[model samples]
Target chain A: MRKLVFGVSAFAGLLLACTAHAQEITVGFVTSLSGPASSIGINYEKGMNAAYAYKDEVSGVKIKLIKLDDGSDPSQATKNARKLVEQDKVDVMIGTSSAPGTNAMMTIANELKVPFFAVSPVNVPIPADGHPWGVSMVQTPQLMVKVIADRMQRDGVKSVGFIGFSDSWGDLVYNGAKAAEANGGPKVLTNERYARTDTSVTAQALKVVAAKPEGFLNGGSATQAALPLLELRKLGFKGPFFGTPSLLNRDFVRIGGKAADGTQVSAGPVVVTSQLPNDHFAKKIGTAFHESFKKVNGGEADDGFSGYAFDGWVVFLEAAKVALTKAKPGTQEFRQALMDAIYANKNVAGTHAIYNFTPKSYFGVDERSLVVVKLADGKWVYQP
Target chain B: MNAQIAAILAIDGIASGAIYVLIAIGFVLIFAVTRIIFVPFGDITAFTALTLASLENKQMPGTVGMVAVLAVMATLMEVFSLWRKGALGKIPAALFFYLALPLIPAAIAWATAGTLLPTPLRLLLTVAVILPIAPLLNRIVYQPIADATVLLLLIVSVALHFAMSGLGLLFFGPEGVRTQSLVDFTTFIAGTPVSGQAMLILGSAIFFSFLLYLFFNFTLYGKALHATAINRTGARLMGIRPQQACTIAFLLGSVLAAVSGILIAPVNTIFYDSGFLIGLKSFVGAIIGGMVSFPVTAIGSMFVGILEGFAAFLSSPFKDVIVFSILIPVLLWRSYTLVHAEEEDEE
Candidate 1:
């Protein structure tokens, strides 16, 4: 009778332990680990791993991360998101490298009613009710391009020529330039487009050179972005060049060689972390992220894409901490609570920017989150 | 646009057209002799450029490892086929041709990868390292089904292209590389400045085309390849081996692709997967030629290049659409002009 009584008590204790351990949260992360975008995707994975190494628990709740590769394909990204939500049963989702892929994943997030954090600068469509299930960790193209436009105005540039990919990204940058133009930015002279895999942008450069704009704005990303700049320089267009954060990569510097010099780009604060003031909001967290990144990845985070992923993880953690107080994980109630907490986040300092998210505004940064950087001597120099 | 801009655009178009001509000729040559479309021709060019870039960076190219693996696989398959046919006496020669010959360049690349070799030597090494790739790929992919229909071969060729692309990503990584220009001078061409690199591309294209003309008209082996391309059975009855003809075609194709890669690496940022679009564009040129006439293919490629330049300038977003749409009218004309031959299922 005593043995039976002890067994029942131990069984009760095991049941209590199981309920206590139910606080664990699962996060589904999808990104492009292979394909053309794998270069950025690998960096995203590295930053996410670093963030995980930095902190894996929130208020005694352990977090489990399930990573999926989309191979930079939008359909694959959507399929991965669905699998993550249905099979992995994640509490919240984070992912994807490219804008299209992230937007594809966003639709799945919306349909599944799961909280999502997009690492790429995807233009999220908010419903008429002013509510969105997903938020972008990276700044919008308009926000980043505005800084370049402002700098161009300050530099007394009257006209600028635009060359970008013949895709949605190009449209995004062109739209941003047009928006900035209404607010005293330089008049955009020409909008030339080229494919990412195009061998030459000679014709586009020639058109841009013929326009004889005082400055040039490249909307292409990665190594391809350097093509128009190189061709423009060859054509003797000695105007200043401007780009967005996508050009903040070693390949751009290396491939562009001498032509990349004097090119200015708008990037997140994490790019110039060391150059920031000591008391800056992003400095403390940015430095910690760098340290943790080097400790985990064995190298400095050379591009802004990684910091975007790290910031996404940090934002997710902040919301998870709050959501854990409301309901057990893996439940619809917990996902709702998590979504609310993400929307309620205020002044959440991350490696890239200080995010202030709300239901209506999915892009959580403003002008203060950006800084102009110049490429000089194969290095990114902070511009004051 | 002014005359100067037009001239500049024309120069740019001719330079890129020259590259397409080389690649299109390669596609036609391989398809004629092997009955395989050889979709990986552009991949071979991309690999050569990547190999040269690795040499320039003083790093061991993944080509050495890739070639070694391919050589072993080709040798094993050759030995198995020879054994099945009871032609055991040909094993030594097969080993030498399929294994040792290919590995020699790979071994040289491996040995000299760390040293600061001269530019010409590096170019030669890059060409040599890539020389066996197409042939060995032939042995692995197309040899077993040598008598398959053209459509089947084309399907296999496309699958091979995707496989090569995946393997390229594994070997070269995702970063793009542009090699130093072989010649670094600009000269005025009718009031428009043209780079020396563009001249080199044009010169090489003309030189190779002339050389191909000479070989086909004057050489016995080249005649044998031409005969095999005309009628495989008749050429075999005339004592020309079709497999030998196919191998020679692939070698010549590889040389053209290698030369094109060398000429293009300085001008364009070459990536692991950049070859697909380049190859596809050239294929469009080949299709315009009805995949038969060499001179027509070259002209078609030049037209494609010039049209691309104009299209890009006129409507930047519709450039690719315009370029690819040329196929419809050309195909319609070909279908109207030519009599359809019933494709026979080969044994």
Candidate 2:
């Protein structure tokens, strides 16, 4: 009789909850899922997306996420961002694997008055000087480059040749190195510029070798950077070589062979999984995200750009949950409340790492969490 | 600053010039016989070098000669088909000709990737990959432009360059192969240390020139080729088959591009776009040497190469300015003489 009574009460509760239709919530994400930059964007997007679905349900609210391919072109990023806002009517936006595209999308978000979250945030201070609506999911180039530079300096590399990709991203890393000069570090022996499409880096490598620099720090995508690695090895250049996060890929191990062993790359050293193997709170939420997202997307989970997408959705849900208390609050009130909540938000350990965005500190996170990773054997096995 | 320094610089130029000379020879040969240059010649060179490097990296067991032989045979087969179709006659010929040339470069690059080739044999293999392309070009783009002199040839050359550049960017993806040095480049001569690769390149250049000279002089085929170069219509009248000579010249031209590319692979990186600059410089060298004459441009290529080395070494940033310096004065002089002579040609 007691069990029967409890079943009837549960049925009545379900009936009561079905009284009114729930408002639709939308989240939009854009990233480079194709092109030469796929090495970074593809893996990143997969990881983030997996992180999103690891939830059973997003904060007691129904969720819908729409993803668009940005193609790694900055101009295309703007158009894609606008479509998500104007046509899709998304409540939030996240994107762009690389900086240029993401920056363009961030600018669009400013005009549209939409909240934007970034995946690959740099160590450079941007969102700090003025932008409040944006936050980075990954460590900045300044931090990442410094990690590699620190390692090289520790290795006693006195003179170095800096080979940079001829693009905005390349420029970003180069600027980071120049800033490090103030510390009175290694004397930069030479600087070489190579077009992104230059495959036969032997010529560029030859010129650098002629300078006889003891070390090389490359800033570019994997293939472009890999060519130089191959050239250096053939010329018997056994000196230490380092790269930005762009060169960090397991495929680099397969293609680069033994030559890749000593090669190092710097990243936020993200330790993302469906669940942290040990952290109890992380395991519970990660399990939910894994199961729900897999149910929706029909695959296993990964902490790719989708993680940002999910994170964007989570931020929105939390804000909406807080905002819902206003019973149809004004957009300003809701936005301000959300911003306050973001400021006060704490201990949000994410696959991309925990978010701690405050008003005054737009970055809201320590840059030192970044670490230098080396390729040992064939994987991104961390070096001490 | 001193005599020895100057001599060393000269030697550097000769070594550098040797690679360019071989590439220039193809440009000169095709220009002379078909009277229109093969614009995709550089792409062909990049294709071969990239393949050889990939092959070398794999440490696959093979002689570079075997690889070269396989490539030449395959290319020659295509040349015959183009010849049969008379694709060398006009637009259809050029269209068909361009289609056939890429197959060989692509094949060599794909098949031989990771194969270790002996250095001398590797150079030979490189020569093999490009050597057969000239004859094919004769039957395609070059021969069609034989009668074209003004905007027509220029348009054709530019168009071919763009197409080849695109395809080169596609197949090679702007990346070139990295080959190990067959000869040690780091060594000392007398009291001074000279780059060993530099000496090897110079030596290769001398050997290539001698081979080129012997090729132009003694062979029956060579005599017939010279006859056609002197007068195509007359050669046709004498049953020398001007068509055959043009095709042969194109083949010979392509071989040099391959040879030079493979030879340079061990010393420096060969890029997909390397051909355009080399092609341009070589064309300049040919013009400086005199278009109709053979050895003049080959010898002139060395002088141009030396100047480039000086330019590159002097200030890497201004290498382009230094190399083109020679071209500007030569052009102005030629134009001055041309306006006075009621010139029949720009060169």
Candidate No. with top DockQ: 1
How does candidate 2 score on lDDT? 0.62
- For residues B1-347, what per-residue lDDT tens digits would candidate 1 score against the true structure? 88887888888889988999999999999888887898999998998899999999999998888999999999999999999999999999999999999999999989887797898899999999999999999888888898988999999999999999989988988888999999999999677899999999999999998999999889999899889888888899999988889889999999999999999999999998899898989999999887878999999988888888877777788888999999999999999999856564464
Per-residue CA lDDT of model 2 for A99-164, tens digit only, reads: 788878877766776667777552334453364665666656677777777777887887777767
User: lDDT for each of the candidates?
Assistant: 0.89, 0.62
> Which clashing pairs does model 1 show?
none
Native RMSD of candidate 1 (Å): 2.9
* Every model's TM-score on chain B: 0.98, 0.77
Give the fraction of true interface contacts kept by model 1: 0.65
What DockQ, on C-alphas, does every prediction get? Answer: 0.65, 0.09
How close is every model to the real structure, measured as TM-score?
0.92, 0.69
